[model samples]
Target chain A: MMEKVAQMIAVTGAQAVAHAMRQIEPDVVAAYPITPQTPIVEYFAKFVADGVVKTEMIPVESEHSAMSAVVGAAAAGARAMTATSANGLALMHEIVYIAASTRLPVVMPVVNRALSGPINIHCDHSDTMAERDSGWIQFYVEDAQEAYDLTILSVRLAEHEHVRLPVMVNQDGFIISHGVEPVSFLPDDVVKKFVGELKPIYPLLDTEHPVTYGPLDLYDYYFEHKRQQIEAMKNVEKVFPEVAQEFFKISGRKYSFVEPYKLDDAEHVMVALGSTNGTVKYTVDKMREEGCKVGLLKIWMFRPFPKDEIQRYLTGRKSVVVLDRSASFGAEAPLYEAVKSSLYESASRPLLSSFIYGLGGRGIAIEDVEEAFEKSISGELVTDYEYYLGLRE
Target chain B: MAEQKGWKDIPIGGTIVEAGSAREYKTGDWRVLRPVYDRSKCIDCMMCWFYCPDLAIIQEDAVMKGIDYYYCKGCGICASVCPKSAIEMKPETDFAEEG
Candidate 1:
């Protein structure tokens, strides 16, 4: 039974990421340490020490500097990247905006963790939620294989000239980030051939040429600056799948901006992102076996929010309940809002709903997901509504 | 399969090099490099004027400032280290080449 669960490799989650960092061969990785997330950076430091990877890894004063230094290195035309989670991601929030706004194609792994106002750090979307609008392409993974594969694919997708956007490949902090599973890492040549070379839109250090980046703006110029950022962001919808298609030819694990699991001919569905998608998918199958017409949506690309594909996936569906691990504070969950907007333009849109199920690393069991689906089907739960599913007394 | 070629091997024979590469400008060719100033955001800040690094920032009034990137490196330090996010970096794509 355990063998079918993917042979357990005698390696920690941090070591898995370390192995990935070596495979990606980033020219510069500058990351500081924190719980669970520390081992990833530490393992890369070990790679630099053991001469396992040919790269420059910087030890910075804080996560802010870690992000700041990578921005500087990437702007100077190096294949640069880093890693962080929760509070660390929040610390680098200012520069994360700069990295994407400047169009430096840096890729980083965000081990999902809860934010700290009350000091909790066990796999929540707070860290990622805070940075959702920061202009990076966010992807969530279900397991170590994805953590390994997406890390490689991220460099390719982020660096694609058409996209040229930073990407955050997130794995749930304790669940996937700390889990050990056998990952058949593609050979170095295969990854190199797949990811290809780095050609920045404008690299700063070229002696024969010079370019300006990350400009400031006033009201007169600010609007257009942001417009251009939007324009660059809008390009990703077409840009992502071309790279993904090529990656599919090699890796065999194909992905879209949003992944649809068993959605066809279905009347009920649950849209989810990140690792929980796996659990929900299994639950969907179980519910389907019980004669329920339900499906699952596993969203991989969170930014540039694959709106059209999302609605197209739901074209024939009857109802959708978005299961979000993060909340928008005083409003609907981000996933729920995105799903609503995607269906906004659809002619045959379904009754859509929002469920803010997980917060502060609290669990949203599969049973809760099934219960939400049952409620949506029988009209016991209103579609034009939001519910915090797992609130504890 | 997509073709992979180095920029060096691209043989870009007719690539247009910017005028800054050569020092000469034809009379009607050089587009005036504009220094967009922020009047409301400006605090009589000479930081842009003083730290022109290339001395591109000009002090028109006692407080108003400007940049002449005829020598500006596009380094953006003036706009970046600015007290307020005021000044901007725009490329002079139409600058005339001088030889």
Candidate 2:
């Protein structure tokens, strides 16, 4: 297939994702507007109103209903999608699990935000982190360009024959969602050919060849059904790269489960996901200028947690600092725990410490990252307890 | 009993590929009370046929025949809706060996 000249446009992360959705032209979009994520569906809604895309847009009452509607549409063999933020994701919690277990390939872009307690609308990983075990293929993007690219890539990944599972493409709430950046697009026709049409195995709408979905599965068969889902997730780990390779051919960007930056022969490394990876990269570059042996590992795909690849990159490093945006209450932070587990089988592993930072959108400046890096290199970072970054004493 | 399928043999996502496969599961075994029809007292109102939730009422050319005990779960909707009391709900124990 011949590649088309990429269209360069300056847009917020939410609008970039919306542009991707418009190009894909999903059959149905059932969404309820929430902060940060609202602009995505809002822009798509405008596309429907202006006759740019012939999508059946359903303005739902709640996030719960929004996901439920998407599930229904997907079951009927339609390519369906939705978007939400922190509290909205929490509201859709139940159906979110259903969408995956039922094996419907629903693509949803989640604008990462802090979960509510005192109720602040800001950037954090609390929302998606809470859903880490919900059986969805999750991708965390660093900028608007990646967000746009991953949103398009997620559709193909979710609908792959061997991996018919839902996908969540995450971007930082207001930091990336509302922040304007230059994003390149792969012309509408190229994207449409790349995504292709969803060919559902047994759609509920195929009346002539009817199939029963969401049946009351009992003890006799429930375990077996869950086993099938496990196998499907395993397929995602394999199929993701193939789909991404095809995407790379059409668009010049490549994606993978973990993206390592300047880790060759580095002694100290910082591990993180989402937009914080961008900051960490800047910090690594600044530290390297002063001859500091520092690098960064950015986990793009969190679920089906890329253990072997992560272990490979961090194996010989002297020390590794994991920055988690969400706290796991009494336990080690989510990403920190995963990194710890991944390294358990390695013959030689880095001395790892967990740092909880930027909860409720507390900004982590370059100085803050430099401070963490300096402490890790000096072996002063605590391994037993998590250090809090940007927390007031 | 049909051979119980292993996880690999079953369809992905627990989807039942065979449409209307519920017909294969004989639910009449669940009936604790059976509805007995008395043809002589029948008013032919077809109320019993219309009210049978299980579609257990056998009918041909709009004419009521005996109930199909194969699927009747004995909800007794047929007996309750009989305008002339043509159908009676009888305890399963009363007809000891009958299916």
Candidate 3:
């Protein structure tokens, strides 16, 4: 195989995702404008107006309609997608579950924002974390490049024969969505070939072979149908690596459920998801230079909750701190809860601690991450209750 | 009755692969009041046929025929729409002993 040189361009995470969408040229894009995620649809719409792609862009009245339109289009066997942010995602909650339950491979790029009460338009995992059980495969990205790559990769993953489930590719609001970075783009032809055409199963448009979707499933079959979704999610875990390997051939960027940085032989570790991983990586490097044995574990696939991999990575560590960007309100933080549960059966379990940070977009400075690591190493971080990072006492 | 399928046997996503499979449901058993057509007073205006939600008002060559009890949920719309009062809502118990 010849060496593949990607076309590198600097753009915001939203534009990087839009560039990916433009390359895929899905049959349908139905979206409503919301902060952070708005530029993604705007750029795609511009591509449509400029005839850069032949996508049928639907200007939806609300995020609910946006998701509903994509669901309908996918049901009709069209490659379909939508984008939304915090409140917009909250509005689309209904159809979001339907899209997954109906087994439509609709790809959505969600700009992670804090679910509102104070109406903040900043970065937090509250939006997608609230949807952990919605049955869609979730991929949280660290940078513009991952956001761009996963948006393309999610297409193949969602439409895979055994995994006919929707995928939500999440990037932090403003932090990644609006932050510009150098994102390398594969040639349009490479992406087009990689994603390929969506061969939908039991499409509603197949008039000759008529099929019913979203039928009234009550007590008789609802439980069984849910069980099928469970099986499909299991298939996602199996197929994710296969699809990621295929993507590696083209983009040359390897991906996995969990990404560990300087983890081997480390005594202390900090685990997180989304863009916070970047901060943790920087802090890990800084701490390592000071002769501290610390590392970071970045969770890429949060839906399947890579329990085994997480357990394998942090098992023998002296201590581990889970940085959760969202709180569960009267419970352990979301990612913290998952990590603790994943390590519950491990005989060599690390001293685990939950550090809630970045709620409503409170910035997590390098010093804040350093503090968490230092506290974990010094045995000062509490395992009994949650600790707040960058929170004023 | 057709055999009920386990999760593995049925298509994924609760999709009904066979179109119009509702025909097998036999909703006629849900009826408490049945509509009986009186051919002697029939006007054949097609009102009953036009108003029947379940398409249970049988028609032959565009001429009104008797109701199809297999699908009719015993809704009185057909009887109420019959201009000549040719259709009457009779208690399903009236012929409980008969088919």
Candidate 4:
């Protein structure tokens, strides 16, 4: 068990993440500044300039090159990381798959924001939900404390032997990104020891035994290479909880694939991700005090789905309402799709429905969640699914 | 047919087995025309050796040892760069006929 005492500091989520980066002292952090995500790199830049962290900060022209540079750096056996939001994440979409397909465990913290057409960006899940299939392990944080902790934890999880996949530690844009909260920070020595020296599996820079990455893998082996990535994701199912348990030994804060709150006898359970869970938890507690059997399951590890665990939680619930911040055009929303698919194979299932809420940084109050839970249990909301919450229609 | 390797047989990240494995994947089959060398008229300028795009022209001790047809794509750069006209582009059918 790690015995180092943590320093309690009040800082924004971006600063918390930047502090974690300073502690990890990654070999390279190539990033381009965009709103919300800008502060993460900005704070780290101050660290680099002040000699607080010796990280080689590469200020690239675009998020594409930031991801590309980090991919190259990680390929050459350096622990690399970066930060981005909505359009920036979209810009890096191509190389994002390359980073995962190449199996370089470079950590990136995505400050979740709305993908723009009207150009409104306060906080939403549209950016990350769009890249749901992009082969990165996503850990959605509900607060600045999680943003700080997961930023450091992502390094350890990404570099694990069983799961050599890139990890995206996600926080809400402007909301958690700019909101200051009291976060207990682990010591630099503890972090350094935890995220030990990276032993790259097949480093391209090894002169004695050279290797290639991102080759033109045609049909002859393209399917097989993809299968390897799928297997790596599957390995996360087993590896993440183990790592989180070990991390808890030192930090005293346990994390899991999915965080359950009062699901033991919940008749109405709301499933969501990111900072919305904070509001849902508060609402659930308030409802429980008034004798409502409502609960919540805030998913942290989004990729690898945690299908069995999710099915285990919502299987026999009386009413299940999934909240997705981003909508899927003509289809079910991303989170709804994932949760529905997980329960599709289960023997017992809940009366399920989905709500599209918090798009373009729309405000979600305790009343909004309460209304959804009430409608879910009462079966009063018709159309059964995709109930638009807080919409003007 | 998928390649014979099981999931474990494949390397983690599409890593090639040996250094310069591209040499093993013969591109000669892609050739429509082939470069034929005349050692008699050769002044050994090494231009053909230097100009061969596929590194097809083999050089031993600074002397051109003829083209390695196995990996030659027959781009005709070797024939074009030869000042002595010692290298000529001929139909690949000639080699097929000879075989």
Best by DockQ: 3
Please give each candidate's TM-score: 0.78, 0.87, 0.88, 0.88
Cα deviation of A81, candidate 2, in Å: 0.7
Task: Candidate 2: list runs displaced more than 4 Å.
Answer: A1-4, B26-99
Per-residue error (Å), model 3, residue B76: 8.8
* Residues forming the 10-long window of minimal summed lDDT in candidate 4 chain A: A376-385
Assess candidate 1 and give its lDDT: 0.77
- List of chain A TM-scores, every candidate: 0.93, 0.98, 0.98, 0.97
In the predicted model 3, the residue pairs found to clash are none
Cα RMSD, model 1: 11.0
Q: Model 4: per-residue lDDT, tens digit, A163-221?
A: 89999999999889999899999987888898889999888788788777777877567
Write the number of the candidate with greater TM-score, choosing between 2 and 3.
3
* Each prediction's DockQ against the real complex: 0.04, 0.63, 0.65, 0.48
lDDT tens digits by residue: candidate 2, A146-236: 9999999999999999989999999999899999998888888889999998999889999888888899888778999899888988998
Q: Mark the regions of model 1 whose C-alpha exceeds 4 Å error after superposition.
A: A1-13, A219-222, B1-99
Query: What's the lDDT for all of these models?
Result: 0.77, 0.91, 0.90, 0.88
- List, residue by residue over B1-99, the lDDT tens digit for candidate 1: 123334333211112224252233222223334345677787876777767666667676766556554555666778776788678655555333431
**B6-98 in candidate 3: lDDT tens per residue?**
887778888899966887777797899999888999977999888999989889988887988888998799888778999899998999899
Worst lDDT window (10 residues) for model 2 chain A?
Answer: A1-10
- As a whole number from 0 to 100, the lDDT of residue A389 in candidate 1 is 79
